[model samples]
Target: MEAAIKFEAHEEVVSFDQEGNVVVNKESHMSKKLMARRAIEAHRERKRLESELEDYYFEEM
Candidate 1:
């Protein structure tokens, strides 16, 4: 027989992953959206940096 898990009325559900980090099972929609937005921002920053480097090289020639 397995023991039943319980939670307090006001407690939020929490779990852990393989790495032992605290994982929140809720707010999936918000988290996914935030992750995607961050990824796009990182990509844009990388491209801007690359463009600046290229311009610098061209100017020196």
Candidate 2:
């Protein structure tokens, strides 16, 4: 089974200069860390739920 929703990490604080170069912002660093932490928690929750479901099925059988 797969997650119903998939998260794709993208750069949102990028701006082009006169030379048309990608300039990343430093503020996005914190947000990226937060996003990574959230993703890990979500993964853990999914695994926990899956394990519980399997145990329930085994008990039913």
Candidate 3:
């Protein structure tokens, strides 16, 4: 047997199997936003690291 739950606040639907394992119906909006934010943060960190390395290389010259 399967059971489903809906969150009215976020309008997200979640399901569960008889064994109590969560089953995702679809990608949630919040998750998409979170992923985007994380991607942006990662890109910024990469750029910062690159800049620091370049500065250090120039200083050593």
Candidate 4:
């Protein structure tokens, strides 16, 4: 019988080397952390611009 594995959010057991480096499998797709960071930074920048625009227009006008 083959063992079964469960995948949680952002969890994929593709492969890892003994040195803890991620192993890439051409057959499998994996999630990456860079996308998350870029998303967060973009959200923050948007919020900052919106706040600044609101303050400038309402306060100056």
By TM-score, the best candidate is: 3
Task: Give each model's whole-structure lDDT.
Answer: 0.56, 0.59, 0.58, 0.54
Model 2 TM-score, 2 decimals: 0.51
lDDT per residue as tens, model 2, 1-61 = 2342222245444454676444445556447676556556655666699799999999999
Which residue runs does candidate 2 get wrong by more than 4 Å?
A: 1-30
Winner of 1 and 4 under lDDT: 1
Rank by lDDT, highest first: 2, 3, 1, 4
lDDT of each residue in 1-61, candidate 4, tens digit only: 1233333334433444686444444433334464445445655666699799999999998
Clashes of 4: 0
Instruction: Output the number of the lDDT-best candidate.
Output: 2
After superposition, candidate 1 runs with Cα above 4 Å error: 1-30
Q: TM-scores for all candidates?
A: 0.51, 0.51, 0.52, 0.47
Deviation of model 4 at 52, angstroms: 0.2
